[model samples]
Target chain A: MIATTTENDSAEHPAVPTAEADRPAQSEARRRRLPFSPWHLLLAPIAVLFAFPFVQMIMVSFMPSRDINRLPPRFIPTTVTLDGYRGLLERSDVLIWLTNTVIVSTVAVGSNVVLCSLAGYGFARLRFRGRNVSFLAILGTIMIPIQLLMIPTYVMFARLHLLNSLAALIVPWLATAFGVFLMRQFFLSVPRELEEAGLLDGASRLRILWHIVLPLARPSLMTLAVFTLVGSWNDLIWPVIAISDSNLFTLQIGLANFQGVRRTEWSLLMAGNVVAVLPLLVGFLVAQKHFLATMSSTGLKG
Target chain B: MARSATVAVPEDASTATGAGRRTQRRSEQLAGMAFVAPAVIVIVGLGIFPAAWATLLALQKWNGFSEPRFVGADNFERMSRDTDLVAAAWHTLLYTGLFMPVSVVGGLLLAAALNRRIRFMGLYRTAIFVPYVASAAVTGLLANFVFNPEVGVVNNVFRVLGLPQQGWLEDPSQAMVVLVIMSLWGQLGFVTVIYLAALQDVDTACLEAAEVDGASASQRFRHITVPQVAPATAFVVIWQTIQCIQLFDLVYTTTRGGPIGATTTLVYYLWEQAFRQLSFGYGSAIAWVLFVVTMVMTLVLVAIQRRRGGEQPA
Candidate 1:
């Protein structure tokens, strides 16, 4: 099942090996010969500590409210119930919030992939006046702290009457400078011969990009999509400021408000958190290798 | 089409193809502009345009609604006298001072432990990294429950051990400490992953040579491993510091900048002033200060890294 999923995920860039393929056979042999390492003594406890909150979140989500409210709270509940999930669904706007978050993230990912790739390819492969200058100016925006822009952005959105709507959340995330930068880097590394061959075949630049470049650029596109999705999904402060309407609140804003109003509702809060986090968690688990590889490589490069 | 086909022929037809090539070049330039138009619009309209507007807003006094009256330097003057800003700055400094080193070093140690040929290395790595994949709001929600003063898990453990219970997030003095812990929990995974990748890229030959000699394990780690990961360390530190400076989501969700303002970091303070208090002009002033501080710190860190002969962070 894992192998099949890995294959499906990397279907775009078949020429590049998956993380599993990168593991050497000698490591498997070595693992068998030395099953124990002293690092485990230190690592085991730390891993448990790291994983404890997740375990607790899951366990407490199912715990009865009485059990949660009891003094000296129980790590493992004696009784399990669906009351938390039920309450979250019936009483709160968690479902609406989840849907809104999904819509925002999906739009963010889609726009970033389509737009950043085009811009990145333009900067990487095409010859044009002021291309270098424009790219540098865009890159410089990355250093301008988002905090510095928020107040004015809020005012601008208000003037444009875009505030209190999903557009406020979606517009800022449509195309990021980092996404453009990452895609440009990836396109620069791609061998030019493929595109050159296409040009010789009388293909327009757009046709070449669509047929020859984007397919090879899938890994980078995936990386950009994942980052943008995570960022938009988890965004809080901006939504908290821009969207005052309860009906349009994203999951983070909804959950933050839920916690504020129902501080004592531990089970409900846990279930809300679980719902907010589970999609990304499942995604990470499915493409763990790709996620790790992308993160590390991107961190090193940018 | 004929021009493309003739391009495969010899340069003897260069004069006829030159005009075609020039047109092709012009078309390519137009295509480039067209391709980049959407991204450039968004970047300039949202990112750069708002930034310039922020500079102007910083110079004017507006409560976000009134007609902007030009008040030169008044907002910045207010910032100098704003005690809340000072307190928030101190808290931000304190958070960075504690959070940066702890997370970075913890990440290094964790990465070193996993950088071996062992069973279930993937599992260990995944476990350590899962928190980073979770949203900060979710993490803050969990932290609130786990650190609740009366009925939370930590207090429960304290009771189980017959130790005195202490107020965590609700405590004025300990709120920042709890905030740091929560931030570290979510960020250490990212730092570890970077360090782990760097560790894997370390020269195995050098380590083997050191082992062949009389270098002890700790000595080898210090001499070989530490220096090898310096660039990664620089990257991690700078990243963590930026994150620490922009520390708002966790604070907003958890403490709302505090039990008596103990955990109010710079970004959180700016948010409160601008959004909550409707002090947009003063907030923009604070925002400019933050931008300046971020740039200076980044440059200084990069300079230090370069002086040590480490590669600049990309």
Candidate 2:
């Protein structure tokens, strides 16, 4: 790579000073000539179109209940207040819901990371009979619509006498096939020399994995952790089916119930929406770099 | 001659070492199996068994309180005869068909637009992706307000334009439309980001080469960009179709499959039968059909992907 770089450098920019020889002259020149290309200008309308709903949601969250409900909707709040927050905090079960959401998401994400990584590593690195078959079968699960699993899962939970429990909310999601696939892809990219070095030192595969592989795989693991955390935190349907007790209801489910129970309580509902969605937004914002990288890498083909 | 003689002696010793290495490899395989056991156990015990049992339950008669009676194919036959189940299946297909094209195509456009290095690109990306990360329940709750028909922001916008106000969720025709639109809104971000990533990795040299060869921008994009991103498109289409077919939360919250079961997709219908009506056997039958439909759709998608792969340049 270094040898080719020198060749390309000499070929492309002979007249440039040696100190500036390595820069991508073409791209840099294009940047200097016209930084704001017409292509870049197309982003404005598209961004606004995509962003309108969120801006509306944020603005509406602060408005007085009556103003929010008006036919000619108030684009901006005439009187901004924390009344919605206060109402939601004091009057609703938002706190309990928030706690439940935290517990379910934490348990689910924690279990998913450990289990999926182990499975992923085994699938990626280990030699075993039926390895391909097992992996394929797991991948097959991804094709099956999750809705098909819902009724059966609910019935099974009911039979297990685990209905309306937090366990119902957390247990089934502990081993996701997608997470395994991601980890397997990541593990495949890791060099075998590191593992061989550990093995030569009389470290068992498990010990080597724990000490060397896990630490090396921190970024991928963090990506998986964030995926699990965000997914579990935002999941809405399973909790609705599984947990009937209001106290056990996660934030999402509780907010739905809150809306149904008090349709006109815009202040409470908006406040609840803000509270429920805040953690997820905060979580994503903090991990935005990892999140974006993971999104692009996993989803796109090129 | 000296080197050859020395190599001949070490060959035997090296063969012994190779044999020992093979033995070590076997033991490592056993240890690897040990490491993978927890995941396999969980998948088999919790995931596979439940799915298999559910398939069997479709053939039985159980209404939660009653002992599950072996009712062999009665549920299936009943499902075939039921108009509601038929309507529900059709609705599901309709929903999936509508959702897939709109979301995937819209996502493609948005992703292509966003992939450009524009001002505040990070903020734009986040703004678009926000809905995807928000809980369906929260979005559904907000949708209720936004599309309330009487005092909804949608109607309010219409009113501002001096147009007729309509109750989006209450009207059957409008209800389904609202559900589809809301689904498109939430799903676009996911598909767009995926496509954006794919777009970034497109070989700029290839594109520039095409441009230099006097290829129009449209021709280059169509012939080069689209084909290169085919795999991403396929991935998005298949997954999006699966997700679309499983549209439950919005339907459940916004319409409850109502204004007269006009929005009754398969899952909602299954939920209604199993949970609300306590008709477990029949509901399981519907659930099985849904599973089969999804499996078939997935297989078809796989077949398409395989065909595409076969045609790709080596």
Candidate 3:
């Protein structure tokens, strides 16, 4: 098939004198002087459809509870109020949930970065017995569904007397198989000569890895940190099962509870949802390029 | 230098450097273990061990509290006979069927549509991708409100159009459809971003050549673009299918498998069995089923990916 393709390409190249015109044609296709492509008209409504919910989420967050439940629903808020937030701050345990979420996410991200980098660096540069096998073991777990892990994990956590505490949440997210694989992939790409230079200078492997390999690993490290942070913060299932205490809830769990308690209280629920969503959005916008690259590359590997 | 010299074994220096090299080699081994310990421990303790333990419990008759009795597949036997299990399995399969294709197809189209440079490209991409980054539970919560029969936007739009207003989540008959659409809304962005990345990476030379050969845009896209992005399409399909199989968070927040168990799914049922009903053995059995299903699908995907990746470079 490849031979045929090459043959066809070779044959076709002579037929189009405009082969030299490829670059010009490509540039012409991308010429931004014309922004009014038929695409914009086709996709604008779809874009709006995708974004309108978020807009409505923001708008309804400020709408009074009464306004939300009104027979003829209002897309826009009749009156904006902080009562939704106020209700959370005053009535619910939003503060505890926020702090728990922060603590869990922070520790999870920190530990993932530190431990995954260590594991990655080890797998990449170290020549130790069973390193390949160990690496494969970690990689192998990436496909095991969380549902399968959930039941036994909960039982184990319960056995350890770790349930209802933040420990359960923090431990699992501390070093993910995927994160380790990601970091290992990144570490493998860093020039070995850089580390070898340090090795030749009588430096230890760990020292070289720290001083040489790690500096070049800034992008992967940040991506891993961001991914870990987003995952730990927004994760719902494990936390939902692990911690029954309302006071120990993460942001997502708190929002679920906020909705559960007042099923009709759309305003407060939306506000809670915004709060649950905003940090990751901030993180994503900040690391958009790295996020896009990492999400797709890692996604395909599975 | 010292280690290399030791390996080369200079006659006199060998004795001194041999000790040093052994120490260095030992240290390297220790360093590897030390470096890898935390991650390996976490993976094993939380990941591998749980799956193994779940498998063990799947065959036992443990309620998580009492002495685990050796049931020897009694739970699996009971699970097969369970009515809720059958219905939930069907519901999950139905959900996966409805959800995966729509997500993959819609995602590809959106990706193709947004593939070109246009005005506010970043804005559109960001808007489409927002729902994906947002928490599932949060979106599911928002969906509940959006699909609320009386006061929700969906039914209001239906009423405005003089269509029969469906009691979306509240109605058992319509709940799964509502849930599926909601799931699609949340997940569409993820698949789109994946495809958009894949689409951008699709070989442009072949596409241009096809176009230059007087191929229509649709034909060129169908013949050239589709094959180039086949790996990505396979990826999206597999990933989305796996996601659908383990569907839990959306169901948890939206309907909680309510209105006469219309929307009860596998994981939802597993949670009910293991956590709510305290039927840990039964839940473990279900977990094993989920584990096997997902692992098989993932392995198949990986195999396909490997073959395609090998063939493509040739």
* lDDT (Cα, tens digit) per residue for candidate 1, span B6-72: 2122211112277878777777777777677788778877888899999998998889777988899
- Docking class for model 1 is acceptable
Q: What is the DockQ of each candidate?
A: 0.41, 0.30, 0.40
Tens-place lDDT per residue, model 2, A71-148, is 576878889878788888888888898888888888777777877887788898888766787787777666555555
Cα shift from native, residue A101, model 1 (Å) = 0.6
Candidate 2 docking quality: incorrect, acceptable, medium or high: acceptable
A3-52: candidate 3 lDDT, tens digit per residue: 34334433322111111111235546765465566668778888898888
Candidate order by decreasing DockQ: 1, 3, 2
Model 3 scores a C-alpha lDDT of 0.77
Clashes of 2: 0
After superposing candidate 3 on the true structure, give the runs of residues whose Cα lies further than 4 Å from its correct spot. Answer: A1-35, B1-18, B300-314
**Candidate 1 off by > 4 Å:** A1-35, A298-302, B1-16, B310-314
lDDT of 3 by residue, B128-164 (tens): 7667677777778878888888788999999889999
Q: What DockQ was computed for model 2?
A: 0.30
TM-score of candidate 3 on Cα atoms, chains taken together: 0.90
Q: Pairs clashing in candidate 1?
A: none
TM-score, cand. 2 vs. native: 0.86
Question: Which pairs clash in model 2?
Answer: none
